[model samples]
Target: METSDQNAAVDALKDPEAFSVIIDRYRYQLSRYIQRLGAFDSDTTKDLLQESFIKVYLNLNDYKPSLSFSSWIYRITHNEVMMHFRYMRNRAQAFASEDALTLFESIPDELDIAVESDARLRSMHIAKALQRLKPEYREILVLRFFEGKSYDEISDILEMAPGTVATYIARGKMALGKVLQEMNITSV
Candidate 1:
Protein backbone atom coordinates (compact mmCIF):
# COMPACT_ATOMS: atom_id res chain seq x y z
CA MET A 1 0.00 0.00 0.00
CA GLU A 2 1.14 3.55 -0.66
CA THR A 3 2.13 5.60 2.32
CA SER A 4 0.04 8.55 3.53
CA ASP A 5 3.07 10.76 2.97
CA GLN A 6 3.17 9.76 -0.67
CA ASN A 7 -0.55 10.32 -0.91
CA ALA A 8 -0.22 13.62 0.90
CA ALA A 9 2.55 14.82 -1.42
CA VAL A 10 0.41 13.96 -4.43
CA ASP A 11 -2.60 15.56 -2.80
CA ALA A 12 -0.62 18.65 -1.86
CA LEU A 13 -0.14 19.49 -5.53
CA LYS A 14 -3.95 19.66 -5.76
CA ASP A 15 -4.15 16.87 -8.27
CA PRO A 16 -7.80 16.62 -9.21
CA GLU A 17 -8.28 12.97 -8.32
CA ALA A 18 -5.43 12.34 -5.89
CA PHE A 19 -7.29 13.49 -2.79
CA SER A 20 -10.28 11.45 -3.81
CA VAL A 21 -8.11 8.38 -4.09
CA ILE A 22 -6.95 8.98 -0.56
CA ILE A 23 -10.53 9.29 0.52
CA ASP A 24 -11.52 6.06 -1.19
CA ARG A 25 -8.58 4.24 0.28
CA TYR A 26 -9.19 5.44 3.78
CA ARG A 27 -12.93 6.00 3.96
CA TYR A 28 -13.89 2.60 5.36
CA GLN A 29 -11.05 2.66 7.81
CA LEU A 30 -11.88 6.22 8.65
CA SER A 31 -15.52 5.34 9.25
CA ARG A 32 -14.48 2.55 11.62
CA TYR A 33 -12.10 5.04 13.15
CA ILE A 34 -14.91 7.45 13.93
CA GLN A 35 -17.07 4.61 15.24
CA ARG A 36 -14.31 3.62 17.62
CA LEU A 37 -14.12 7.22 18.72
CA GLY A 38 -17.75 6.78 19.83
CA ALA A 39 -19.65 8.34 16.99
CA PHE A 40 -22.70 6.60 15.55
CA ASP A 41 -24.63 6.96 12.29
CA SER A 42 -26.06 10.35 13.20
CA ASP A 43 -25.69 13.73 11.52
CA THR A 44 -23.05 14.75 14.04
CA THR A 45 -20.80 11.83 13.17
CA LYS A 46 -21.48 12.32 9.49
CA ASP A 47 -20.58 15.99 9.72
CA LEU A 48 -17.50 15.18 11.77
CA LEU A 49 -16.31 12.67 9.16
CA GLN A 50 -16.72 15.27 6.44
CA GLU A 51 -14.95 17.90 8.51
CA SER A 52 -12.08 15.55 9.34
CA PHE A 53 -11.34 14.84 5.69
CA ILE A 54 -11.33 18.53 4.84
CA LYS A 55 -9.00 19.14 7.73
CA VAL A 56 -6.72 16.37 6.45
CA TYR A 57 -6.67 17.76 2.95
CA LEU A 58 -6.18 21.36 4.04
CA ASN A 59 -3.21 20.35 6.15
CA LEU A 60 -1.86 17.70 3.80
CA ASN A 61 1.14 19.83 2.97
CA ASP A 62 2.19 19.89 6.59
CA TYR A 63 2.48 16.10 6.77
CA LYS A 64 5.94 14.63 6.82
CA PRO A 65 6.32 11.69 4.45
CA SER A 66 8.40 9.91 7.11
CA LEU A 67 5.30 8.96 9.12
CA SER A 68 2.69 6.31 8.53
CA PHE A 69 -0.20 7.94 6.67
CA SER A 70 -2.61 5.70 8.52
CA SER A 71 -1.47 7.02 11.86
CA TRP A 72 -1.31 10.58 10.62
CA ILE A 73 -4.83 10.49 9.23
CA TYR A 74 -6.03 8.90 12.42
CA ARG A 75 -4.29 11.57 14.43
CA ILE A 76 -6.17 14.18 12.47
CA THR A 77 -9.46 12.34 12.90
CA HIS A 78 -8.75 11.85 16.58
CA ASN A 79 -7.95 15.51 17.06
CA GLU A 80 -11.06 16.59 15.22
CA VAL A 81 -13.27 14.23 17.18
CA MET A 82 -11.75 15.27 20.47
CA MET A 83 -12.06 18.89 19.49
CA HIS A 84 -15.71 18.36 18.68
CA PHE A 85 -16.22 16.81 22.06
CA ARG A 86 -14.52 19.77 23.66
CA TYR A 87 -16.71 22.16 21.75
CA MET A 88 -19.79 20.24 22.86
CA ARG A 89 -18.55 20.43 26.43
CA ASN A 90 -18.33 24.20 26.23
CA ARG A 91 -21.53 24.57 24.26
CA ALA A 92 -23.35 22.27 26.63
CA GLN A 93 -23.14 25.01 29.21
CA ALA A 94 -24.10 28.01 27.08
CA PHE A 95 -27.08 26.68 25.21
CA ALA A 96 -30.34 24.86 25.42
CA SER A 97 -30.14 24.79 21.67
CA GLU A 98 -31.77 21.75 20.12
CA ASP A 99 -30.06 22.61 16.86
CA ALA A 100 -26.64 21.86 18.27
CA LEU A 101 -27.60 18.59 19.89
CA THR A 102 -27.12 15.18 18.34
CA LEU A 103 -30.18 13.17 17.41
CA PHE A 104 -29.57 10.52 20.07
CA GLU A 105 -32.89 11.50 21.56
CA SER A 106 -34.49 9.98 18.49
CA ILE A 107 -33.27 6.52 19.42
CA PRO A 108 -35.60 4.36 21.43
CA ASP A 109 -34.17 3.66 24.89
CA GLU A 110 -35.24 0.00 24.75
CA LEU A 111 -33.58 -0.42 21.36
CA ASP A 112 -30.30 0.97 22.60
CA ILE A 113 -30.42 -1.31 25.64
CA ALA A 114 -31.14 -4.36 23.50
CA VAL A 115 -28.29 -3.48 21.20
CA GLU A 116 -25.88 -3.20 24.10
CA SER A 117 -27.10 -6.50 25.46
CA ASP A 118 -26.62 -8.03 22.02
CA ALA A 119 -23.06 -6.84 22.03
CA ARG A 120 -22.57 -9.47 24.69
CA LEU A 121 -23.03 -12.12 22.02
CA ARG A 122 -20.09 -10.86 19.96
CA SER A 123 -17.32 -12.77 21.74
CA MET A 124 -19.40 -15.74 22.74
CA HIS A 125 -19.36 -16.49 26.45
CA ILE A 126 -15.83 -15.22 26.77
CA ALA A 127 -16.66 -11.98 25.10
CA LYS A 128 -19.77 -11.55 27.17
CA ALA A 129 -17.66 -11.80 30.29
CA LEU A 130 -15.28 -9.20 28.98
CA GLN A 131 -18.06 -6.61 28.91
CA ARG A 132 -17.76 -6.21 32.64
CA LEU A 133 -14.16 -5.14 32.21
CA LYS A 134 -12.75 -1.66 32.45
CA PRO A 135 -12.64 0.31 29.23
CA GLU A 136 -8.91 -0.30 28.82
CA TYR A 137 -9.34 -4.06 29.00
CA ARG A 138 -12.42 -3.98 26.82
CA GLU A 139 -10.47 -1.98 24.23
CA ILE A 140 -7.71 -4.54 24.06
CA LEU A 141 -10.23 -7.35 23.76
CA VAL A 142 -12.19 -5.64 21.00
CA LEU A 143 -9.15 -4.67 18.99
CA ARG A 144 -7.99 -8.27 19.08
CA PHE A 145 -11.12 -10.42 19.06
CA PHE A 146 -13.69 -8.26 17.32
CA GLU A 147 -11.47 -6.51 14.80
CA GLY A 148 -9.01 -9.41 14.41
CA LYS A 149 -6.14 -6.98 13.93
CA SER A 150 -2.58 -8.18 14.47
CA TYR A 151 -0.68 -7.44 17.63
CA ASP A 152 1.61 -5.19 15.65
CA GLU A 153 -1.38 -3.41 14.20
CA ILE A 154 -2.94 -3.05 17.62
CA SER A 155 0.40 -1.85 18.92
CA ASP A 156 0.58 0.71 16.16
CA ILE A 157 -3.04 1.74 16.60
CA LEU A 158 -2.98 1.88 20.37
CA GLU A 159 0.51 3.44 20.38
CA MET A 160 1.62 0.87 22.87
CA ALA A 161 4.85 -1.08 22.88
CA PRO A 162 4.41 -4.43 21.12
CA GLY A 163 5.22 -6.40 24.27
CA THR A 164 2.75 -4.39 26.30
CA VAL A 165 0.08 -5.14 23.76
CA ALA A 166 0.74 -8.86 24.09
CA THR A 167 0.66 -8.72 27.86
CA TYR A 168 -2.58 -6.83 27.85
CA ILE A 169 -4.22 -9.28 25.47
CA ALA A 170 -3.09 -12.24 27.52
CA ARG A 171 -4.30 -10.72 30.75
CA GLY A 172 -7.47 -9.50 29.16
CA LYS A 173 -8.27 -12.97 27.87
CA MET A 174 -7.66 -14.43 31.28
CA ALA A 175 -9.88 -11.84 32.86
CA LEU A 176 -12.59 -12.59 30.36
CA GLY A 177 -12.34 -16.30 31.02
CA LYS A 178 -12.74 -15.63 34.73
CA VAL A 179 -15.77 -13.53 34.08
CA LEU A 180 -17.24 -16.24 31.88
CA GLN A 181 -17.11 -18.69 34.77
CA GLU A 182 -18.74 -16.20 37.09
CA MET A 183 -21.49 -15.59 34.57
CA ASN A 184 -21.99 -19.32 34.16
CA ILE A 185 -21.02 -19.10 30.53
CA THR A 186 -19.24 -22.26 29.56
CA SER A 187 -16.46 -22.01 27.04
CA VAL A 188 -16.71 -24.50 24.23
Candidate 2:
Protein backbone atom coordinates (compact mmCIF):
# COMPACT_ATOMS: atom_id res chain seq x y z
CA MET A 1 0.00 0.00 0.00
CA GLU A 2 1.23 3.48 -0.82
CA THR A 3 2.03 5.47 2.24
CA SER A 4 -0.94 7.73 2.88
CA ASP A 5 0.81 11.04 2.92
CA GLN A 6 -1.15 14.22 3.58
CA ASN A 7 -1.22 15.24 -0.03
CA ALA A 8 -2.27 11.80 -1.24
CA ALA A 9 -5.16 11.87 1.21
CA VAL A 10 -6.37 15.14 -0.26
CA ASP A 11 -5.97 13.90 -3.80
CA ALA A 12 -7.75 10.64 -3.12
CA LEU A 13 -10.89 12.28 -1.81
CA LYS A 14 -11.00 14.85 -4.57
CA ASP A 15 -10.34 12.51 -7.51
CA PRO A 16 -11.66 9.05 -8.22
CA GLU A 17 -8.54 8.23 -10.20
CA ALA A 18 -6.42 9.27 -7.28
CA PHE A 19 -8.35 6.77 -5.14
CA SER A 20 -7.62 4.18 -7.80
CA VAL A 21 -3.97 4.56 -6.97
CA ILE A 22 -4.75 3.59 -3.40
CA ILE A 23 -6.73 0.62 -4.69
CA ASP A 24 -3.88 -0.34 -6.99
CA ARG A 25 -1.67 -0.31 -3.95
CA TYR A 26 -3.85 -2.51 -1.75
CA ARG A 27 -5.85 -4.42 -4.36
CA TYR A 28 -4.21 -7.79 -3.96
CA GLN A 29 -3.83 -7.46 -0.22
CA LEU A 30 -7.50 -6.71 0.34
CA SER A 31 -8.73 -9.22 -2.25
CA ARG A 32 -6.75 -11.92 -0.56
CA TYR A 33 -8.67 -10.96 2.55
CA ILE A 34 -12.05 -11.09 0.81
CA GLN A 35 -11.23 -14.31 -1.01
CA ARG A 36 -10.45 -15.99 2.27
CA LEU A 37 -13.95 -15.15 3.45
CA GLY A 38 -15.45 -16.84 0.35
CA ALA A 39 -16.40 -13.56 -1.21
CA PHE A 40 -16.00 -13.29 -4.97
CA ASP A 41 -18.11 -10.41 -6.09
CA SER A 42 -15.43 -8.76 -8.17
CA ASP A 43 -17.42 -5.53 -8.47
CA THR A 44 -18.68 -5.51 -4.88
CA THR A 45 -15.33 -6.45 -3.42
CA LYS A 46 -13.78 -3.71 -5.48
CA ASP A 47 -16.54 -1.43 -4.35
CA LEU A 48 -15.73 -2.21 -0.72
CA LEU A 49 -12.08 -1.55 -1.37
CA GLN A 50 -12.93 1.74 -2.99
CA GLU A 51 -15.30 2.52 -0.16
CA SER A 52 -12.51 2.02 2.36
CA PHE A 53 -10.35 4.44 0.46
CA ILE A 54 -13.19 6.89 0.14
CA LYS A 55 -13.83 6.79 3.86
CA VAL A 56 -10.19 7.44 4.43
CA TYR A 57 -10.36 10.33 2.03
CA LEU A 58 -13.50 11.79 3.52
CA ASN A 59 -12.26 11.37 7.05
CA LEU A 60 -8.73 12.55 6.50
CA ASN A 61 -9.53 15.65 8.44
CA ASP A 62 -10.36 13.51 11.43
CA TYR A 63 -7.24 11.39 11.16
CA LYS A 64 -4.66 12.18 13.80
CA PRO A 65 -1.95 11.55 11.18
CA SER A 66 0.00 9.74 13.87
CA LEU A 67 -1.29 6.23 13.36
CA SER A 68 -0.45 3.55 10.86
CA PHE A 69 -2.51 3.98 7.74
CA SER A 70 -2.65 0.23 7.29
CA SER A 71 -4.49 -0.49 10.53
CA TRP A 72 -6.82 2.45 10.13
CA ILE A 73 -7.82 1.60 6.60
CA TYR A 74 -8.20 -2.09 7.35
CA ARG A 75 -10.32 -1.43 10.44
CA ILE A 76 -12.69 0.54 8.31
CA THR A 77 -12.75 -2.08 5.60
CA HIS A 78 -13.48 -4.81 8.13
CA ASN A 79 -16.41 -2.98 9.66
CA GLU A 80 -17.71 -2.05 6.26
CA VAL A 81 -17.58 -5.61 5.02
CA MET A 82 -19.47 -6.85 8.07
CA MET A 83 -22.09 -4.16 7.61
CA HIS A 84 -22.28 -5.02 3.95
CA PHE A 85 -23.01 -8.63 4.68
CA ARG A 86 -25.71 -7.67 7.14
CA TYR A 87 -27.23 -5.10 4.82
CA MET A 88 -27.43 -7.52 1.93
CA ARG A 89 -29.05 -10.06 4.18
CA ASN A 90 -32.07 -8.00 5.25
CA ARG A 91 -32.48 -5.50 2.48
CA ALA A 92 -33.29 -6.00 -1.24
CA GLN A 93 -35.76 -8.82 -1.86
CA ALA A 94 -33.49 -10.53 -4.36
CA PHE A 95 -32.24 -13.38 -2.20
CA ALA A 96 -33.84 -15.67 0.32
CA SER A 97 -31.13 -14.94 2.89
CA GLU A 98 -27.50 -14.05 3.46
CA ASP A 99 -26.74 -17.75 3.42
CA ALA A 100 -28.04 -18.04 -0.11
CA LEU A 101 -26.05 -15.06 -1.28
CA THR A 102 -22.98 -16.44 0.37
CA LEU A 103 -23.61 -19.75 -1.32
CA PHE A 104 -23.47 -18.08 -4.71
CA GLU A 105 -20.95 -15.24 -4.41
CA SER A 106 -18.48 -16.74 -2.00
CA ILE A 107 -17.75 -19.89 -3.95
CA PRO A 108 -16.21 -18.14 -6.96
CA ASP A 109 -13.78 -16.31 -4.73
CA GLU A 110 -12.75 -19.37 -2.78
CA LEU A 111 -10.71 -20.60 -5.71
CA ASP A 112 -9.25 -17.32 -6.85
CA ILE A 113 -5.60 -18.24 -6.65
CA ALA A 114 -2.73 -16.53 -8.41
CA VAL A 115 -1.55 -19.48 -10.38
CA GLU A 116 -0.35 -20.30 -13.85
CA SER A 117 -1.87 -22.70 -16.40
CA ASP A 118 -5.39 -24.13 -15.99
CA ALA A 119 -6.42 -21.26 -13.75
CA ARG A 120 -10.08 -21.81 -14.52
CA LEU A 121 -9.85 -25.50 -13.66
CA ARG A 122 -8.09 -24.75 -10.40
CA SER A 123 -10.74 -22.18 -9.58
CA MET A 124 -13.42 -24.80 -10.05
CA HIS A 125 -11.65 -27.06 -7.63
CA ILE A 126 -11.30 -24.20 -5.22
CA ALA A 127 -14.95 -23.32 -5.43
CA LYS A 128 -16.04 -26.88 -4.91
CA ALA A 129 -13.86 -27.15 -1.83
CA LEU A 130 -15.19 -23.95 -0.33
CA GLN A 131 -18.82 -25.02 -0.68
CA ARG A 132 -18.20 -27.91 1.69
CA LEU A 133 -17.10 -25.63 4.53
CA LYS A 134 -19.37 -24.53 7.38
CA PRO A 135 -20.03 -20.82 7.57
CA GLU A 136 -18.00 -20.29 10.75
CA TYR A 137 -15.01 -22.00 9.20
CA ARG A 138 -15.54 -20.10 5.98
CA GLU A 139 -15.71 -16.70 7.69
CA ILE A 140 -12.41 -17.10 9.52
CA LEU A 141 -10.64 -18.27 6.40
CA VAL A 142 -11.86 -15.25 4.52
CA LEU A 143 -10.84 -12.87 7.28
CA ARG A 144 -7.30 -14.18 7.38
CA PHE A 145 -6.96 -14.74 3.64
CA PHE A 146 -8.48 -11.46 2.53
CA GLU A 147 -7.44 -9.08 5.28
CA GLY A 148 -4.09 -10.64 6.13
CA LYS A 149 -4.77 -9.59 9.67
CA SER A 150 -3.03 -11.23 12.60
CA TYR A 151 -4.83 -13.46 15.05
CA ASP A 152 -5.21 -10.69 17.60
CA GLU A 153 -6.50 -8.24 15.05
CA ILE A 154 -9.07 -10.74 13.91
CA SER A 155 -9.98 -11.52 17.50
CA ASP A 156 -10.62 -7.86 18.04
CA ILE A 157 -12.58 -7.52 14.84
CA LEU A 158 -14.77 -10.51 15.54
CA GLU A 159 -14.86 -9.75 19.25
CA MET A 160 -13.81 -13.25 20.00
CA ALA A 161 -11.03 -14.44 22.23
CA PRO A 162 -7.63 -14.89 20.60
CA GLY A 163 -7.75 -18.61 21.26
CA THR A 164 -11.15 -18.68 19.63
CA VAL A 165 -9.79 -16.99 16.57
CA ALA A 166 -6.93 -19.43 16.44
CA THR A 167 -9.30 -22.35 16.72
CA TYR A 168 -11.53 -21.03 13.98
CA ILE A 169 -8.66 -20.30 11.62
CA ALA A 170 -7.14 -23.70 12.26
CA ARG A 171 -10.42 -25.52 11.90
CA GLY A 172 -11.31 -23.56 8.78
CA LYS A 173 -7.96 -24.29 7.16
CA MET A 174 -8.18 -27.97 8.00
CA ALA A 175 -11.69 -28.12 6.58
CA LEU A 176 -10.52 -26.38 3.44
CA GLY A 177 -7.66 -28.81 3.01
CA LYS A 178 -9.91 -31.75 3.57
CA VAL A 179 -12.39 -30.43 1.06
CA LEU A 180 -9.60 -30.04 -1.50
CA GLN A 181 -8.43 -33.58 -0.82
CA GLU A 182 -11.90 -34.93 -1.38
CA MET A 183 -11.93 -33.16 -4.73
CA ASN A 184 -8.48 -34.55 -5.55
CA ILE A 185 -7.19 -31.03 -6.04
CA THR A 186 -3.94 -30.13 -4.35
CA SER A 187 -4.52 -27.32 -1.93
CA VAL A 188 -2.82 -24.08 -2.85
Candidate 3:
Protein backbone atom coordinates (compact mmCIF):
# COMPACT_ATOMS: atom_id res chain seq x y z
CA MET A 1 0.00 0.00 0.00
CA GLU A 2 1.08 3.56 -0.54
CA THR A 3 2.25 5.41 2.54
CA SER A 4 -0.20 7.98 3.78
CA ASP A 5 0.96 11.53 4.42
CA GLN A 6 0.29 11.02 8.13
CA ASN A 7 2.51 7.96 8.16
CA ALA A 8 5.19 9.87 6.35
CA ALA A 9 5.03 12.53 9.03
CA VAL A 10 5.45 9.93 11.74
CA ASP A 11 8.40 8.38 9.92
CA ALA A 12 9.92 11.78 9.28
CA LEU A 13 9.88 12.48 13.01
CA LYS A 14 11.98 9.39 13.58
CA ASP A 15 14.41 9.80 10.69
CA PRO A 16 14.97 13.29 9.36
CA GLU A 17 15.82 11.82 5.96
CA ALA A 18 12.21 10.67 5.66
CA PHE A 19 11.18 14.30 5.62
CA SER A 20 12.36 14.55 2.02
CA VAL A 21 9.44 12.33 1.04
CA ILE A 22 7.03 14.88 2.43
CA ILE A 23 8.85 17.74 0.75
CA ASP A 24 8.96 15.97 -2.60
CA ARG A 25 5.28 15.13 -2.41
CA TYR A 26 4.17 18.64 -1.62
CA ARG A 27 6.69 20.80 -3.48
CA TYR A 28 4.97 21.14 -6.84
CA GLN A 29 1.45 21.63 -5.53
CA LEU A 30 2.59 24.08 -2.91
CA SER A 31 4.77 25.97 -5.39
CA ARG A 32 1.86 26.41 -7.74
CA TYR A 33 -0.30 27.38 -4.80
CA ILE A 34 2.19 30.00 -3.72
CA GLN A 35 2.09 31.46 -7.21
CA ARG A 36 -1.67 31.47 -7.14
CA LEU A 37 -1.53 33.28 -3.82
CA GLY A 38 0.49 36.07 -5.47
CA ALA A 39 4.14 35.18 -5.46
CA PHE A 40 4.41 36.02 -9.12
CA ASP A 41 8.15 35.73 -9.65
CA SER A 42 9.89 32.37 -9.59
CA ASP A 43 12.63 33.57 -7.27
CA THR A 44 10.17 34.98 -4.75
CA THR A 45 8.02 31.86 -4.94
CA LYS A 46 11.07 29.62 -4.47
CA ASP A 47 12.28 31.64 -1.52
CA LEU A 48 8.87 31.58 0.16
CA LEU A 49 8.61 27.85 -0.48
CA GLN A 50 12.04 27.24 1.03
CA GLU A 51 11.09 29.23 4.10
CA SER A 52 7.78 27.42 4.41
CA PHE A 53 9.47 24.01 4.10
CA ILE A 54 11.97 24.95 6.74
CA LYS A 55 9.15 25.99 9.05
CA VAL A 56 7.40 22.72 8.32
CA TYR A 57 10.55 20.75 9.12
CA LEU A 58 11.07 22.62 12.35
CA ASN A 59 7.46 22.18 13.40
CA LEU A 60 7.16 18.50 12.49
CA ASN A 61 6.91 17.69 16.17
CA ASP A 62 3.65 19.62 16.24
CA TYR A 63 2.03 17.71 13.40
CA LYS A 64 -1.29 16.40 14.69
CA PRO A 65 -2.61 13.34 12.93
CA SER A 66 -6.16 14.55 13.54
CA LEU A 67 -5.56 17.12 10.83
CA SER A 68 -4.48 15.89 7.41
CA PHE A 69 -0.83 16.72 6.84
CA SER A 70 -1.77 18.46 3.61
CA SER A 71 -3.91 20.95 5.49
CA TRP A 72 -1.19 21.68 7.99
CA ILE A 73 1.44 22.23 5.32
CA TYR A 74 -0.85 24.43 3.29
CA ARG A 75 -1.71 26.47 6.36
CA ILE A 76 1.95 27.08 6.92
CA THR A 77 2.53 28.00 3.29
CA HIS A 78 -0.47 30.33 3.25
CA ASN A 79 0.78 32.15 6.32
CA GLU A 80 4.18 32.55 4.75
CA VAL A 81 2.70 34.17 1.65
CA MET A 82 0.52 36.47 3.73
CA MET A 83 3.52 37.51 5.78
CA HIS A 84 5.43 38.27 2.60
CA PHE A 85 2.61 40.48 1.41
CA ARG A 86 2.44 42.29 4.74
CA TYR A 87 6.17 42.84 4.72
CA MET A 88 6.09 44.15 1.18
CA ARG A 89 3.04 46.32 1.92
CA ASN A 90 1.50 45.63 -1.45
CA ARG A 91 -1.75 44.11 -2.59
CA ALA A 92 -1.70 40.76 -4.34
CA GLN A 93 -1.09 40.97 -8.06
CA ALA A 94 -2.78 39.38 -11.07
CA PHE A 95 -1.92 35.85 -12.16
CA ALA A 96 0.70 35.38 -14.84
CA SER A 97 -0.88 35.03 -18.31
CA GLU A 98 -0.40 31.26 -18.37
CA ASP A 99 -1.81 30.83 -14.88
CA ALA A 100 -4.67 33.15 -15.79
CA LEU A 101 -5.54 30.82 -18.67
CA THR A 102 -5.51 27.80 -16.39
CA LEU A 103 -7.57 29.57 -13.74
CA PHE A 104 -10.04 30.84 -16.36
CA GLU A 105 -10.45 27.38 -17.89
CA SER A 106 -11.61 25.95 -14.58
CA ILE A 107 -13.95 28.86 -13.87
CA PRO A 108 -16.34 28.80 -16.84
CA ASP A 109 -18.11 25.63 -15.74
CA GLU A 110 -18.62 27.01 -12.26
CA LEU A 111 -19.84 30.38 -13.55
CA ASP A 112 -22.17 28.78 -16.11
CA ILE A 113 -20.40 30.63 -18.87
CA ALA A 114 -19.61 29.29 -22.30
CA VAL A 115 -15.98 29.25 -23.29
CA GLU A 116 -15.61 32.08 -25.74
CA SER A 117 -13.70 32.01 -29.01
CA ASP A 118 -11.04 34.46 -27.91
CA ALA A 119 -9.84 32.58 -24.86
CA ARG A 120 -6.75 34.76 -24.49
CA LEU A 121 -8.77 37.96 -24.14
CA ARG A 122 -11.31 36.26 -21.90
CA SER A 123 -8.51 34.95 -19.73
CA MET A 124 -7.04 38.41 -19.38
CA HIS A 125 -10.45 39.72 -18.36
CA ILE A 126 -10.84 36.90 -15.87
CA ALA A 127 -7.44 37.66 -14.38
CA LYS A 128 -8.34 41.31 -13.98
CA ALA A 129 -11.68 40.39 -12.45
CA LEU A 130 -9.98 38.05 -9.99
CA GLN A 131 -7.69 40.86 -8.91
CA ARG A 132 -10.66 43.10 -8.17
CA LEU A 133 -12.16 40.66 -5.67
CA LYS A 134 -11.72 41.12 -1.92
CA PRO A 135 -8.64 39.35 -0.62
CA GLU A 136 -10.61 36.86 1.46
CA TYR A 137 -12.83 35.98 -1.47
CA ARG A 138 -9.93 35.61 -3.86
CA GLU A 139 -7.98 33.42 -1.45
CA ILE A 140 -10.95 31.15 -0.84
CA LEU A 141 -11.64 30.89 -4.57
CA VAL A 142 -8.02 30.01 -5.27
CA LEU A 143 -7.92 27.39 -2.55
CA ARG A 144 -11.28 25.87 -3.44
CA PHE A 145 -10.99 25.90 -7.24
CA PHE A 146 -7.42 26.53 -8.29
CA GLU A 147 -5.84 24.38 -5.60
CA GLY A 148 -8.70 21.84 -5.45
CA LYS A 149 -8.98 21.97 -1.67
CA SER A 150 -12.14 20.71 0.01
CA TYR A 151 -14.09 22.78 2.50
CA ASP A 152 -12.73 20.84 5.44
CA GLU A 153 -9.19 21.17 4.16
CA ILE A 154 -9.64 24.89 3.47
CA SER A 155 -11.07 25.33 6.94
CA ASP A 156 -8.03 23.73 8.49
CA ILE A 157 -5.65 25.68 6.28
CA LEU A 158 -7.28 29.06 6.82
CA GLU A 159 -8.27 28.34 10.40
CA MET A 160 -11.81 29.26 9.50
CA ALA A 161 -14.92 27.22 10.12
CA PRO A 162 -16.08 24.96 7.29
CA GLY A 163 -19.29 26.95 7.03
CA THR A 164 -17.26 30.11 6.56
CA VAL A 165 -15.26 28.43 3.82
CA ALA A 166 -18.48 27.51 2.04
CA THR A 167 -19.82 30.99 2.48
CA TYR A 168 -16.67 32.54 1.10
CA ILE A 169 -16.71 30.25 -1.90
CA ALA A 170 -20.31 31.13 -2.72
CA ARG A 171 -19.76 34.83 -2.28
CA GLY A 172 -16.48 34.70 -4.13
CA LYS A 173 -18.14 33.04 -7.10
CA MET A 174 -20.87 35.66 -7.08
CA ALA A 175 -18.40 38.50 -6.85
CA LEU A 176 -16.31 37.00 -9.63
CA GLY A 177 -19.39 36.63 -11.79
CA LYS A 178 -20.34 40.24 -11.17
CA VAL A 179 -16.87 41.37 -12.14
CA LEU A 180 -16.94 39.26 -15.28
CA GLN A 181 -20.28 40.77 -16.16
CA GLU A 182 -18.89 44.26 -15.67
CA MET A 183 -16.17 43.29 -18.11
CA ASN A 184 -18.95 42.27 -20.58
CA ILE A 185 -18.07 38.58 -20.45
CA THR A 186 -21.65 37.37 -20.26
CA SER A 187 -22.82 33.82 -19.87
CA VAL A 188 -24.59 32.14 -22.80
User: Residues 47-166, candidate 3, lDDT per residue (tens digit)?
Assistant: 999999999989988989889889999999999898998998875775667766654555635545553568787766766776788879978988887788889999999999999899
Task: In angstroms, give how far residue 115 of model 1 lies from its true place.
Answer: 16
TM-score of 3: 0.87
Which of the two, 2 or 3, has more lDDT?
3
Q: TM-scores of the models, in the given order?
A: 0.55, 0.56, 0.87
Instruction: Give the top-scoring candidate (TM-score).
Output: 3
In model 2, what are the clashing residue pairs, if there are any? Answer: 32-145, 32-146, 33-145, 33-146, 33-147, 34-146, 36-142, 37-142, 38-106
Residues 36-129, model 1: lDDT tens digits: 4443444666788889989988887767655567766766876787688677762112112232132122212211122123332432333234
* Model 2 / residue 90 / CA error / Å: 9.5
* Angstrom error at residue 164, model 3: 1.5
- For residue 159, give model 3's deviation from the true position in Å: 0.8
Residue 154, model 3, lDDT: 99
The C-alpha stretches of model 3 lying farther than 4 A from their native spots are: 102-104, 111-119
